[model samples]
Target: MHAIDVNELYHILYTKLGPRHWWPARSTEELLCGMILIQNTNYKNVDRSLANLDAATNFGLAALLALPDGQLQALIRPSGFYKNKARYLRAVLQAYHDHYHELAALPTPSLRKRLRDLPGVGNETADVMLLYVFMRPAFVADSYSRRLFARLGQDAPYPQLQAHIAPTMRLNIAQAQEFHALLDDYGKLGPDVFGLADQYQLKL
Candidate 1:
């Protein structure tokens, strides 16, 4: 155990693992698709699904919004749970079209509320979107984070976990983004494999 804080863990991971610059996308819509599609699945499948969507719509958000439900479902089928995810995507697009007159301009907290109000967006997804897309300093308390922290003798509900872990990491937008990516990516290196779990005991 390092007996460390979140900030120190971030530095260690950053030095060892290098930069992530995660949520790989060239546009907000692509990022939206990514955050939605990546749920309950890995990135490889999400990449294939995104490629299919690009082939179908030439990488245009308007074209995606106009795509029929069945076709949208088919294009993203490789991501698994296609029908539900298609509906989720449609709901998000519809929300954007109907109400996104100035959403990106809102404060991060307000933006998080709106994102969470959408059909499939949860706290984790909303925070990721906020951090990566809207350039907000929001830390994502995702499953990987929980697992990693549990191993460190710290486990709680999301809000409690957030309170426990966030204060130690004094992060701005870029640092918040990198910190979260490191927690998740390093945590994925489980005890049996190449992750951070087998290497250290984090009592803090």
Candidate 2:
């Protein structure tokens, strides 16, 4: 297990991926909802779900809470795990209503903690909400991140990858945001840009 030079990887991937413009949310609420819905599914599925929801109504706190569970489940079906994702969405909306009385009123840390405590939420999902929706400094890790680091020969586990990359991201919130976007973009481009065959000795 060898350590990877993330700074070098960052530069290489950035040059390959260019500007990512990640998270792809139109609003704070949409971004937060997308973060939850995106789990275990591709962005295309997530977009389909969002489009379905958006076509029917505004997808606001009140609108979503007002919708029937079955209807909501149907709308977000594209994201897969419909019933479970619906339940998770309902719980998060309820938490917003119950605790802060409104989405705008919720404090970043408190909201993040509450969301993280929910059944389906995990570090990656929570960090997405924190970073994209709340504009916080949280780092997000996904399979792409893990694969990229592993292909670079960093033998550390996924959890440890965050610590390794965070410090090198310049300690500025904006830089962290860009760094994440770049990594995500690099991931979206797949292994081709990272010299996957040369690095891992595998054929594409």
Candidate 3:
């Protein structure tokens, strides 16, 4: 079987799906807060929670930080896991506020490490923040990416898969962001879209 060409796959997906309009947030603070609120929840719930937060405090990091614990939890209740999520969101926002200026000056690797050090920020979440929020050339090898590549006969864990694919594409920030969005949206289309079930199969 031939190796899956990451560039080719990216192009194919992009051609079919166009732009994904992903990471639907207006500001870095909103995106960061979303990075926490979105955990273990669906997009709709996250959207609703973001809307609730916006209505209450205009979705500013400072605003969220100023909210009382109960108020914060209540606003994000729609996203589920309200108790833990509120704590994590508060911690992340506080950290971001503390280092807001310093963060913009850090390199991509350093920024990713710093974000990872924050509460509830994992590799995938950090990558999402890097690509969408910070506009870094980070590839998010999330579950959708894994499933999509696995179907095309390239199955590896997060780090390996990320390393394998990131360099191959050599994408700029905009392209990298779109690739992730397109891949995830395509993954949600099941095994039939683009005849992927057969077309992308390994030639065993």
Q: What C-alpha RMSD separates each model from the true structure?
A: 2.7, 4.9, 2.4
Candidate 1 lDDT, tens digit per residue, 114-141?
9999888988888877777677778778
RMSD of 1: 2.7
Candidate 3 Cα misplacement greater than 4 A, ranges? 1-4, 200-204
Tens digits of lDDT, candidate 3, 76-182: 99999999899888888887788767887899888999998887888898888788777888889998888878878878899888777766666788888899988
In candidate 3, the residue pairs with backbone N, CA or C atoms under 3 Å apart (3 or more residues apart, or in different chains) clash, namely: none
In candidate 1, which residue ranges exceed 4 Å CA deviation? 1-3, 192-204
What would the TM-scores of all predictions be?
0.85, 0.78, 0.90
Provide the overall lDDT of each model, using Cα atoms, as 2-decimal numbers: 0.80, 0.69, 0.82
Q: Which rank order by lDDT, best down to worst?
A: 3, 1, 2
lDDT of 1 at 45: 99
What is the alpha-carbon lDDT of model 1 when measured against the actual structure?
0.80
Give candidate 1's TM-score.
Answer: 0.85
Comparing candidate 2 with candidate 3, which one achieves the higher TM-score?
3
- How close to the true structure is residue 34 of candidate 2, measured as C-alpha lDDT? 86
